[model samples]
Target: MLTYDVVVPVKLLAEAKTRLSPSLDRSARADLARAFVLDTIDAALAAERVAQVIVVGDLSGHVDEVPAGVVVVAEPEPRSLSAAIRHGIAEARRIAVDERVAGERAGRRSTRSHRGIAVLLGDLPALTPHALDAALGAASRHPLAFMPDAEATGTTLATAAAHTRFEPAFGADSAMLHRALGFHDLSHDVPAPLAERMRRDVDTIDALDAAVRLGLGAHTTAALAAREDRGAPGDHRTDAQPSSRPIDSTRKGAA
Candidate 1:
């Protein structure tokens, strides 16, 4: 019953996955980057309520063909994740408004556009179809929603109308910032699978190892398999453990 388009921020891979540096070399980091992005995109594409998947940035040469039915947008300015997300939201609104106006100008059946949009970070490899559906369904009933990360510090998933004042406030204390904006927190299970997907990505070696054990996305799976084939031929599987920085949940509100 949810109807909305989702905006996802896909930044340059080489510049991202910085945490992986401590555990992997440059090539390995790139491999990890490919995996996280591919998985994120795949999840977004698979979402049922997601009518349109917009990648608001120039991922030229970095990302492969955006999944079918998804649109690739070039962020006029490539500054930060907030900047990219803002650009995409504005564009989504513009498209909706355009549709409305065109219908009016034609004096025809008004094909109303989506009522709102949801901004999701592109790194949740553990995301599942049911979880995504549940989130969107819940959001559909609320005017604004805030989904905190496993640590509940970062904003994993947030929903707002195109006009809702969803100021990025990505530095720290993001949870409080959204609350100040009058958005309600809609925290879910943060399941182990969801947490792992939402938790640390290919940032550090620990995360990469986690992804390997969890079974990477198609692209990352292929890349990892290729690496294994070319590797010294060793059993590299193990019970991936959590990272050191678990984003302590009991931490202060504004850190």
Candidate 2:
């Protein structure tokens, strides 16, 4: 049975995707941020095993606009990405506990079926629903699994439950940190899937260019298409705003 829920942590536009500054101007960077948020949610929702797509962070007032089938949870203040993920774990735990106490959910939280949760990075441009499902399908075998970035140097996807002691060090050496947490360390398996066109994240202009160069995931592709259709002119852009307000750490992970 499908084992766990999916948690996606999105960083604020002003604070996230700053490294893309080399290739994209501030406006473009912000646009990419918007696209990333929308795309990640879309991918999460499309996954078959993903019971819930928990968006943990300050939504920048776009919570209502998130694609249908996704759940938005707002953090009241700015917190580290790692903290936000930890919060998601707690929320998933609560769901599991509630379900277990009331009556067991078939695949949602099976005590006999290994419990796992996926912490999906928010900026994946090459992400796809099918690829995500395939990755989770692989993870169903082992209780823990880690899907790293294209470079295999950094981890982009991590699987664990609230009790798994998943400590996230969201900087350099993230892969090692995840391995230390007892995650399945698969570099070539999930990260290198050929059919998975949308797994690359947008942290640099290089990444953005690569995504554009190589096609985008359905969510990212659709978002960009929508943006193009809407036609953001000089002042009509929704991504022009900048805010220093940090992502909140408060736990509001309810459905």
Candidate 3:
């Protein structure tokens, strides 16, 4: 089976999930963002077709810690989502090259199978290993492939095989952009429920509610429960405006 090195990018905590500000305080939003990343990573790590999960961004003071076996790539200066993914892609390529070289020096063929690179958004609190694997299984058929977000206007996953160019267009109307760029859309290839799980990225309160209906990952569930435990301050604003930042495949502050 084809395997993939997945790259997930997060924005600085303070800047993440600002769209949900009216309902949550800055600290709460940060905590929620961190939880989202954790859950997303957990799902990616659990995926059978995934070879490695590379996280990109400065998570200092945001995430308490990441689990072992996951690689953390420092976010590039200027904090562009595209740049972060590109950096991760570079790291993935480097790791692949190093593995091949080491195997050659050992006078034996590499035990690892052919691998591809996939950029997955970090805001999929409800993502599951099965959903991701299903999408990736479809993606493996094409040199370049992408999965659109639940709304079908954005993207959630972008992938490229080892021999192809890894061009990730993930911000603002990303689905259309990827399609225009000739990346195969794998939406119809996965089962409906599993595809919804892969596309359920959270940015707004309504979106979170939708994800909750689908069942969220452990960290995301805990994060929400924590809010209730703390009696969540009186900052609830139902009229909160959506974040004005460029809407990406994931959350608002991905850049």
Candidate 4:
């Protein structure tokens, strides 16, 4: 099995998931953003191939909510989604070097070698450990690999070998960009059960309903339940807009 250092970049709650505003209030949307990230981190930690999980962003107020053993790199200085991802990857590399040095100093044999870094979207509430593990397993076969989002236009997950430069092109139509940059498309070749689940990132009410049907992580489920209890509009379904509408560009980057 290959072990990966997973990097998840999240925007501050106040600026995330704007498209959902039609159905949910600002506070509800913020809560959902946090829930999605928490669920994503939980699933990453549970994955067998994940050696370390690093969350990079401005999570100042919600730092306490982060689970133990997960590293949180605060980006108080705001940057682009791609920049945040690069920051997280740098941190993962630092951690990997530190671990190797510590092992050498202690004259202890390291049980595993860090294969490379993996970037996962923060909004994948339906993500599961099994699915992440399978994706990473498939990703290990290539020096660079990416999985497209359910829409097949954006990238949900990407990986690069330890020695390779991980320049993440993670914005609108990132799947095509990554492919143009020579990153292998692993989803079509692998087509594993977990890959399907990992690709369903929720950005709209219809996507949220799809995730709910697929079963969400505990945090997301609780957040939605709370919203329902508050009588939020839409109830995860509304005919306010067509599902085929493009995702807002403001809602495109980061988790």
Candidate 5:
């Protein structure tokens, strides 16, 4: 069994979830974006195989939402999802080195033993611990792996086993890019609800509504409820994947 250091990248709230602008006002979108990252982190931390979580983003505004014990690395300059994830992977390597040194000083086994790196999109508010664990368990068998999003057109998760190169090409057509980069796709055969939960990355109103139907994390649930309480107008009953249209290309960088 391999324990993973899951790295999640969150784009600036102001620039995130732009496609949802039609469904939520700027302020509301920011709130919901914060909720999405917070909820994703919470679920990642709960995964049994996840040993550490490295969040790469400028979360100064949402500092209070980040749980204690999780690592926070500053987002890279120019702010692309791939850059953020690369920074996080660097941080993970640093942490692993430090742990190994500490273990050596204590005359114990290397603390980084059986460790892997996984990049999970911060937009997965519907992701559950069990679903993540299952995905990770499957990923552990491969040196490099990726999971496509619900629409099967984008990537939601990418993984690299210990001692493997962490080359993540996350953006538009990420699924195809990852496949071209030799990452094994884990989307072929996975259990029903687990796979569904893992693939649900909220982007458009339809996607958000789908996640809501699948069950959202506490933060996301509260954010939506707060909007409803404020009498804010938004669509929460839209059908999931109503069209054959792909996710907005402009909203590609960060999951």
Candidate 6:
């Protein structure tokens, strides 16, 4: 049914979600980052089209927080978002090759099929299994497919067919970049609710509020609940500023 090895790359908590610093403290931001990843992974695992999930990043001190059965690939050297995605894709390829070789050596007819690799952003706190399944199902029809973020300028999810090289261009205006590179935009193909929820990648206070309204993952919900319990302000309204600009968290020491 077109299963995929989903790859999610996350930056260290200490360096993540810096753009929200004006509204959230360091510890709160870290908790939110961890919650986002946990929720993202959980949703990906729950998707029917997902075969495996690979988390690539410097999560040494936080490995235990990840759910069981998900694979973790350490990023010893901090690198660009594109580089981290390449590393995760390479690891997925390596595992696939190893399994094929093992099957050949065992003289057993290989039952495993070559599956595509899906790169999912870790900050999609409002992502749902149904939305992910619908997206993946639509993506399977194209050799390369991508969905733009809620603003329609950035990319939130990208998928490449089995055995095909996924040259990711994830930065400012990444949606245009992927389209320029021939990745079909699958944004309109998914269900309306799925498209709306899936594109809501939380980066700013406003986006976080939108995610909360749409229903956040358990980790994010709890994190926000704790903050509310402490009498911390939960208003996510932002001052006049351009929300279209992308938030690049991969820069070294951004926080």
Q: Which of the numbered candidates is closest to the native, going by highest TM-score?
A: 5
Candidate 4 at residue 72, lDDT? 90
* CA deviation > 4 Å runs, candidate 6: 76-78, 111-113, 232-255
**lDDT computed for candidate 4:** 0.83
Q: Going through the candidates in order, what is the number of backbone clashes in each?
A: 2, 8, 0, 0, 0, 0
lDDT, candidates in the order shown: 0.62, 0.63, 0.84, 0.83, 0.85, 0.81
Minimal lDDT window, size 10, model 6: 246-255
State every prediction's TM-score relative to the real structure.
0.78, 0.76, 0.91, 0.91, 0.93, 0.89
Backbone clash total for model 6 is 0
TM-score, prediction 1? 0.78
Candidates ranked, most accurate by lDDT first: 5, 3, 4, 6, 2, 1
lDDT per residue, candidate 3, 103-214, as tens digits?
A: 9999979745378899999999889999999999999999999999998988999999877887889988899999999999989999999999998888877777778888
Candidate with the greatest lDDT versus the true structure: 5
Give, for candidate 3, the lowest lDDT window spanning 10 residues.
236-245
Over the stretch 22-51, how does candidate 1's per-residue lDDT look in tens digits?
444566655555566666777767778767
Worst 10 residues of 4 by lDDT: 236-245
Worst 10 residues of 2 by lDDT: 246-255
Give lDDT tens digits, candidate 6, residues 158-253. 999887878877767898989999999989999888988788888777677678778888988887777767766632332323344444553221
Candidate 2 has a TM-score of 0.76
CA lDDT for candidate 6: 0.81
Model 2 over residues 93-122: C-alpha lDDT tens digits? 777777676555454444622467778888
